[model samples]
Target: MNAPRGTGPYVDAHHHVWDLSARDQDWLAGAALAPLRRNFTLADLAPEARAAGVGATVLVQTVTVADETPEFLALAADSDLVAGVVGRTDLTRPDVADTLARLRELPGGRRLVGIRHQVQGERDPEWLLRPDVRRGLAAVADAGLAHDLVVLPHQLPSCARAAADHPGLTFVLDHLGKPPIASGVLEPWASAVRALAARPNTVCKLSGMVTEADHAQWTVDDLRPYADTVLHAFGPERLMFGSDWPVSLLAAPYGAVLDAAELLTRSLGADAHAEVFAGTARRVYGLPGG
Candidate 1:
């Protein structure tokens, strides 16, 4: 129940944890993602988060199974560090609302604040607009959960349209829609992201840039354009910070991620900095304790 207090107790709005023994993360298959193949429980994240002054965090889903969300809720119920869980459910399922209700009735169900899907993995850019998906999203909105968008650059248009159509739901864009930072190009991605942000319901996370860039040689300067674009598009209140955790381990350590975020957002004033680091997350994901 710890809240954001003083200049510390920052909220990390996005991170992930998985137990390989419990279940396999099919997404962590590639050689490039081999580093994340091992188990990463909250225990593994707690020290780094605490050292970084991260008092609360929203644990995001890595897989698209119904079982994973319940496991996440159970983990949240037990962890002092994890204050919220943004889990996954089959959004295309007709029983989405009922499934969501069942999730809420679980152990840490009260901590279920948001839902996410592997929208980036979908080949079709307009998947969010599908009738079944829209219905599921409405169910999530009715449940009062924010929807975390993890789509590619081309998917931004549909994200914007979905947000416009589902005004009752809040859209939290993850990883800046996986910007093309490694290529050092910002055209279509930048413009598309701006269009998505134009929707009042949309918010963006300043996360995953290190991995998005040339992982081995990425610099804070390399991430500036994307970060700046999001900063300008969403401003402080509409923008939040996320570590992207285990995935971030591929590019940089935990503290380094926070350091780069600090450097990228140095231009913002104290209040704005606070918002990006903590306040925005607390507000957007509705993380517990202020």
Candidate 2:
């Protein structure tokens, strides 16, 4: 084993923080994700992550509601470990640019580094290609923050088209298009992922894949193919490790997840390992301490 050094100073590119008391994450209350229905605060995450040596975290928005991002920004401001916020903004909104501007003025709004729309939940494979949606994404790019894509495997083609359309924007793909690892299918998902990775402006996050598999029976090896596919497609420089935190709890513990990623990258040269484990996230998200 490479036995890579500590996780401190590594930029955990994707994670989430939420409070059930503040608003209902209805999706989590459903059977598939009921375990995460309760509140998951920064305080709850910090200690567990700290044990893994994680210095800073990027708090991603879990809901599409307008208030969710602002709430996350406030949480980032209050927490020392939260170095950035990848908040959500309705890109299809007529005033997306203005909305992002407004977001910048909130408590930890200045920590805002990117915007993400839960395109995966929309279910329309071409959802990202809608003209108005593209316009909003363009605005997000035109503004300066990176655009994080959360989409399903079948949507990768449209995502590629969107990435091509907005070369000026930095695109971060969440969960490697969330390949169907549990079923052992790979062709289309693998091919599409490679195509998306071909875009110089795009990057991929190695996260959330466990839950996509058999959440109750997944093992590190079950996640290996998806991870291996993404590593080959995006390479170490464009790839980054993300814990996906509270949400990942449904499948594995934080430390175990971190260890899996570490083990996967063990054979890489020191510099390449650093890039995947930390460097890439720092540059892609403009994280501090780079």
Candidate 3:
């Protein structure tokens, strides 16, 4: 379907899709993300996405299980709007290189643009700097795939260090390192996000900030600092917009997230807006016909 004329070319670079009947989402079983316990398919997201001027999207993984990776690949194979996928893999596995190779052979594995681990859930702050993890990251780089860092503020430095260590791999930080937005604290997170952005290969995703803020009353102002800081750090060339979708539903609707992003960058020139809206995502994920 063609996007309406005179509007932006938008691509929600971060979103998720899941079917509970097909497989369990162990992470959403808890209270924090309990609202997303049910299935969220493309049909449920497309209308909101289209209303927001999104022409395509990158489907991210919700579960850490290896089995789910292939499932997502299959889903992408059957969905045209799913431009790319950031799938999960046990990076610590000694056979991680083999795993990546095998995954590339799967149906939509060719669309496997990046790899992500639920590192934010790990107790170790230095989990990313672990020797095994570093080796696995090298395998991802060697396989010519981007590595998406799903981490917290505390892990930003280690994440930065990892990016520095592996210059060959493209590092995309998830959710601006998930800043402490609810309390309005910006010191360490801002500093860390900038430091990470200093690495040429590292880019940041403008996603998940709403959930980090007070869910009930969060507004565009609440999301500005995080977005502004990242924009300054990575600049429009390396930054991209993402909905976080059902996860974002905890704080606001999908269209609201796009509106917040649109409002935040209103001052940016049209060229810059075009890049942030869709160009950066196309460059990062290697979107079709880009």
Candidate 4:
């Protein structure tokens, strides 16, 4: 069962935690990302989550390495704030199912609700549709887990096609396909979003938008068109909220991110507000006591 509907008690559908000593995050490169080069722990996030009324969260993958997922699952096992985890794995590997099974048997394994590959970083936009990747996605379905799409706008068509190819697996689209809100453009993105949402097997996370916008001067109005596009197309029930956390710190504080999401969804009415903020995450991730 999904979480109960309401105006509060939110579920953050996406966030990440990392320790540099634990493992190197090769993606945290460049001078612009200096703020995130340090370790971000659950201890650092707990108070922030509590302050924002984030009752639970889905800990997402930061790198393509296998060590990160088990590390995240172990973290989830010890913390109540993390209700589920979307970990990483080599989706193209022949023993992908065995790897998932091994992950499930790890310390924090039961909390493993989904799998995500950094498809956006892949040079090929059609990476998700590759036969090996599709077979791995099918194995994820056989294991009863959801798959997350962390692709860019240009890669969304392939994501949609992959979702169609693997009807039994639920595809969770992270960050609204990473829209170009900073540029105020919404074409190819909107149309591609519609294509992905057309599949019942797909859902989207209303996350990472603040970072995508002009961080220093972003307004809720600037974020509206993109949010409304997903809200109206996928509806609140198919969309879940995610803070993107320390990554969001590059743009706004945690509270500001939640405030912006609330502002955008104010017209969704009470029930829908609850679904977008918490219910959808609970349903899709199968968090316990939902």
Candidate 1 lDDT by residue in tens digits, 1-290? 12223376789999999888989888787799989989998899999999889999999998877699898899899999999999999999999999999999999999999999999999989999999999999999999999999999999999999999999999999999998899999989999999998999999999999999998999888999899999999999999989999899999999889888888887788899899989989988777665
Judge candidate 4 at residue 125 and give its lDDT: 89
| TM-score per candidate, chains pooled | 0.96, 0.95, 0.95, 0.96
- Of 1 and 3, which scores higher on TM-score? 1
As a whole number from 0 to 100, the lDDT of residue 103 in candidate 1 is 93
Query: Which stretches in model 3 have alpha-carbon errors above 4 Å?
Result: 1-6, 30-32
Q: Give all candidates' CA lDDT scores.
A: 0.91, 0.85, 0.88, 0.90
Q: RMSD of each candidate?
A: 3.2, 1.7, 2.7, 3.2
What does the lDDT read for residue 9 in candidate 2?
A: 64
Model 1 poorest ten-residue lDDT run: 1-10
Q: Is candidate 1 or candidate 2 better by TM-score?
A: 1
* 203-239: candidate 3 lDDT, tens digit per residue: 9888888899999998778888889999999998899
**Model 2, residue 11: C-alpha shift (Å):** 1.9
Q: How well does model 4 score by local distance difference test?
A: 0.90
Off by over 4 Å in 4: 1-6
Error of 2 at 116 (Å): 0.7
